[model samples]
Target: MELISSAERNRLFESFKQDAFHLELRDDYSVPDEESPFTSWTRGESVDYSFMESWTQLIRSATSEGKTVRRVRVITEPHTPYIQWEHETTGINDEAGEDIRWLPRHRLPEGITFPMQGNDWWLYDDKLLAVGHFDDEGRVLGSEVITAPDVVAECVRVRDLLWGLAIPHGEYQP
Candidate 1:
């Protein structure tokens, strides 16, 4: 399990031939960069989105190239503070050309299972898998790159199933 750096991940995104899909199963993410912004949002203070400009640009460039970028987040209802913050700000990703969807955890279809220990992942072109590793507190540790056929196959199954059941961000109130 080789851990891929952020730069490598960006390169993969730039080089993907068709589509990039992400599956987020966690309800709370403890990204350090989001701490201050999350705190401000909790306080009802105006939050700055300038920090996301680069990422948004990346997505915009990808979509403009006719490559698709999509993600589905599985969240618990009555949302956690982090989930609430994510829900409130998903427009940033949408405006950048990414398709985002929300699925309530309880609504997942019965007997369906996820691959890669149920961790979050970015599947590029249905070939490469970048599985996210998080610390006990939910902070990012690093992403592990996997290229095994069986594993990628299972992830594809998970993506297809959950994506079909997820609601578009605009219609999801959570």
Candidate 2:
């Protein structure tokens, strides 16, 4: 409902979840995605680690006021070495150790397909990109959507590259 500013984006990152505020970067700068999946396919803008932490903090804050959080969907090029590098660097993929959740594009229902990938078309869910902002016992609060187009593009493009790398259902890639 409200568009957050760069300053606010920064603050949220520093004082919040280490991965709280993420931004999107695109591989194809010439094309700005009109069908931003923030509305359809995936959730939240990609952010630097600082912003990511702040996002986590904001979710906790909402819960302090009585809310619950359960899921967050991140769209990324499943093949990006950066994905693994970041998780490995930030310790976000520690299984029973950290808070990061990795969902390859193929895992979600109808999440991946052809023509879409070959033409560099990939869609993600914005609804899924949010935290619960729940109650102490896990009830429900509101939602947080990352609407910044730049961040969205970054995420989408990165995921596109990864899609290229991903071993498809029929072992397809073109």
Candidate 3:
């Protein structure tokens, strides 16, 4: 249960050699930086994406080094505004070399199970799991890094199962 800062997580992204897989289960994220953009998007105003430069660059660098960067977002249909915003802005991630996929929560396969963490996580090279922690308001607190074999195996299993059922960003309408 070692909590890590964003900079430390970025270091993991920069160092992973094989693959980086993110599982996003939350329907809304109350990130302070996204408040303005989300408001603008809801108002039908053009939203600025400059804030994503650093992340996009990191993904690009990872993919350029022959590592795969991918994510599977489990969203509810008739999405929350935040999820819609994320879906709309996914192109930035795609252009930056990430493979994004969507899975409607209801479409989840029967009998599927999640790890005990039951939170969003970034699994690096199928070995390290950086589990995201959020406050009740959906604000990110920090990530906990776990390397235990059983936990890591569970996360890997969840990632693969959901990833296989998710629709590619380009193909998913919502």
Candidate 4:
């Protein structure tokens, strides 16, 4: 199980030919880069969004090329503070041309199971996956790249199913 840093995983965007889809299963993400801004947001202070520039820029470039970037967040009802912060900031992602949706955990299809041990994953062109791993503190460790056809197929199936049930960010209220 080789792990690649998030930066390296992001590089997959440079070569993916069509769509990149992300399945987010966590209610809280203790991302170091987001700590300061998230803290400010939690404190009811203005958050400078400059920290997101690199990522948004990447999304913009990809979408401008006619490539699609999408995400489905599987969340819990009565959102966590981190999720609320994410919801508030998601418009920036939308503005950059990514399509993000929200699906409450309770809404998941009955008997449905997540592959890759329920880790969050980014699937590129429905062929490769970057499965996220986390530390005990819930901080991102890195992502493991997986290309087994069987695994990718399972993730693709899950993506299609969940995407259909998720509400677009613009339409979702908490």
Clashes of each: 0, 41, 0, 0
In the range 61-160, model 4's lDDT, one tens digit per residue, is 9999999999999999999999999999999999999999999999999999999889999999989999999999999999999999999999999999
- For model 4, state the Cα shift of residue 118 in Å: 0.7
Query: Residue 97 error for model 3, in Å?
Result: 0.5
Candidate 4: C-alpha lDDT? 0.96
Maximum-TM-score candidate: 4
Instruction: Score every model by TM-score.
Output: 0.96, 0.28, 0.96, 0.99
Please report, in order, the local distance difference test score of every candidate based on alpha carbons: 0.90, 0.34, 0.90, 0.96
Predicted candidate 2 versus true structure: per-residue lDDT over 52-110, tens digit per residue? 45444655564454433222223355545433334333332222122333445444445
Best by lDDT: 4
- For candidate 1, the clash count comes to 0
Clashes of 3: 0
In model 3, state the lDDT of residue 137: 88
lDDT of 2 at 163: 38
How accurate locally is residue 135 in candidate 2, as Cα lDDT from 0 to 100? 32
On the 0 to 100 scale, the lDDT of residue 98 in model 3 is 98
Native-to-model Cα distance after best TM-score fit, residue 44 in candidate 2, in Å = 30
